[model samples]
Target: MTRLTAALVILGLVILVTWALWQRSTAAEARADLAEQRLAESQQREAQHQMIIDSLWDNARRQANQRRALAKQQAALTRIASNRLATIEELQRENQALRAWAGTRLPDAVIRLRKRPAVTGAGAYHQSVRDPQPLQPARE
Candidate 1:
């Protein structure tokens, strides 16, 4: 009876030890899986943050380029306007000189033009000047 009781106790201890080892291995596996998951999640967040930073830089670069283009366009327009104004002033001066010459050359004609308000209606002067004799070139 004593030997049988000793054998039964040994068998029970063996079963208990096997069960504890199995439980320990399962817990360790669960901890390793949890750690790996956390690491994966951290790497993904880092990649996402990097992408966001890159996009911001790209946006800023594009805006700067657009601003530069706009500034260049504004400078070109300013130059063109200045040139046009200068040309218009030159033409006005030339027109004044021509008017003075005409007054000296044909005083009577100028007086007649001044007395008569110009025919402003469309085609009013189209057929008005009809001298039967064509003008001859002057002999100097």
Candidate 2:
């Protein structure tokens, strides 16, 4: 009877140890799975962050290029405007010189004749037939 009881007790102890080992193994596996899930989530978040940064960099680069192009266009326009201003100043000087030369060369009588108002229609036709009167010099 004692031997039988001892054998039963030993068997029960063995079963309990096996059950404890199985529980421990299952708990360890659960912890490992949780860690793996957390790692995957962290990796995904990093990828998203990296993508956002890349997009921002690209936008900044494009804007900088546009600004550079705009500055270049403005510089070109300024250069053209300066060149046109120089040409206009030269033309004005030339016009003044020509006016001075023409004033000296043309006779006063001829200038007066050029300044006279034109008579139109019947009046103009009659004036052309009559002896023309000498035009009076204009007062400044």
Candidate 3:
């Protein structure tokens, strides 16, 4: 009976030790699983953050390129406008010189007729008879 009791007590101690070992292993596995999950979540957040930063940098580069192109186009347009203004001024000067030359070259009688206001119907025939010469084109 003493041997049987001692054997039972030893068997109970072995079972308790086994249960404690199992609990400790299970707890360790749970802790490792939690740490692994946390590591995966951190990696996922870092990937997402890196993607956002890369996208922002691309957008900034595109905007800078767009701004540079716009500035170049504006400068070209400004130069074109300035050149056009100079051309217009030159045309105006040429028109003034042509008018002055025309006044000097025209016959006095034709000039006087041009200065007179148009007279309607019955008076138009009298005016036409006074200037019977065929009109001539201006010399270039």
Candidate 4:
């Protein structure tokens, strides 16, 4: 083949190879961009999941603290009640009049008060606590 013709063929082959390399570079860049986008999305999802987990942990911690506080309060109240009962029993033992009074039947009003269902909530407690008759008027 003529040198000029061989050179033209070589130049064409060079152009073809350069074009193919450019196409491959662009494709690689597109894949890299897509990978970066997917990575960003995954990181966002992970962050949201971590936030939810942290919130749940915080809530659990708060509830545990509340339960501990409630248990401590209950223990204190139980101790107070026991002490009061002991004092009353001691007094009852020491005094014949008090023992006789304790043995007497409770008043109907007192029995009704004791038998009433426990009230719940602020509104209900307020309503329940209001005395219908603060004091019995002196009989005419």
Candidate 5:
């Protein structure tokens, strides 16, 4: 009976030691996999940010081209151009922030949030706001 009890105790100890060693080896692999996952997620975030910046750039470019084509021919469009310029500046600022984010490896934290414009109607012209002629009443 004493021999049997001692054998059971030895068997339990052996099993516990084996389990501990196995856990240590598996933990290292899990840590490596976690690092790889973090890298992949970072890359994906950068790609998404790049796409957003590209879209904003396209919108700003289109607005500039339209402003050029209109070229003081229409008073409403010129006001719209001013609004567009404001909008473009906002976009450029945000774009620069995103560029900085991408240039640095995606940090775990963002220092500052980007500011966005709050203009209505997508920067289209309103008859009321004549920027250059603000001193006088708007001409029909």
Candidate 6:
């Protein structure tokens, strides 16, 4: 081959190698950009998931606190009822008249009230207690 032909062939090979390297570099950059986008999306999804978990946890904590408060209230009510019953029994033991009253059966209206289903609120309880309807006979 002539010197000029050899030089031309060498130059063409150099250009081809440079073009291949540039294409590979561009492909690597594209892959890097895609990886970064995927990472950002994953982080956002994780943040949303964490938010849901935190909300659930807060709700659970609130329910537990309410349960504890209700339990304390129930204990206090039970103590008060027991004390009142004890006082009534002591007074009955000390007086003949009181013993006779304690021995008597509850009134029909009071018995019917005790047998009914529990009401929800204070207003509902008051309404139920004050209702003027006659009591229904108990089923056999």
RMSD of 5: 24.7
Q: Rate the local accuracy (lDDT) of all candidates.
A: 0.81, 0.86, 0.86, 0.90, 0.74, 0.92
Angstrom error of the Cα, residue 52, model 1: value is 2.7
- Find the candidate with the highest TM-score and give its number: 4
Q: Which ten residues in a row have the lowest lDDT in candidate 3?
A: 131-140
Show model 5 residue runs off by greater than 4 Å: 1-21, 72-140
Better of 2 and 6 by lDDT: 6
Clashes of each: 0, 0, 0, 0, 0, 0
Assess every candidate by TM-score. 0.55, 0.63, 0.63, 0.73, 0.38, 0.70
lDDT of 3 by residue, 1-140 (tens): 99999999999999999999999999999999999999999999999999999999999999999999999999999999999988877776889875566457667657766866576777786876676564555565
lDDT of 4 by residue, 15-119 (tens): 999999999999999999999999999999999999999999999999999999999999999999999999999999999999999999987667777876688
Best by lDDT: 6
TM-score of 2: 0.63
Candidate 2's C-alpha runs over 4 A off are 97-140
Off by over 4 Å in 6: 112-140
Residue 28 lDDT in candidate 3: 100
lDDT of 1 by residue, 26-121 (tens): 999999999999999999999999999999999999999999999999999999999998887777678987556645755554555565546676
Which stretch of 10 consecutive residues in model 5 shows the poorest summed lDDT?
A: 108-117
Instruction: Tell me the deviation in Å of residue 120 in model 5.
Output: 16
Where does candidate 6 have its weakest 10-residue lDDT segment?
131-140
lDDT of 5 by residue, 1-140 (tens): 99999999999999999999999989999999999999999999999999999999999999999987777568777888999988877776789775566568532222211222233773434532433433333355
- Candidate 4 residue spans exceeding 4 A from truth: 1-4, 119-140
Q: How displaced is residue 106 in candidate 5, in Å?
A: 71
> For model 6, how does the per-residue alpha-carbon lDDT over 16-102 read when each residue is reduced to its tens digit?
999999999999999999999999999999999999999999999999999999999999999999999999989989999999987
Ranking according to TM-score, highest score first? 4, 6, 2, 3, 1, 5
Question: How many clashes would you count in candidate 1?
Answer: 0
Q: Which of the two candidates, 3 or 4, achieves a greater TM-score against the reference? A: 4
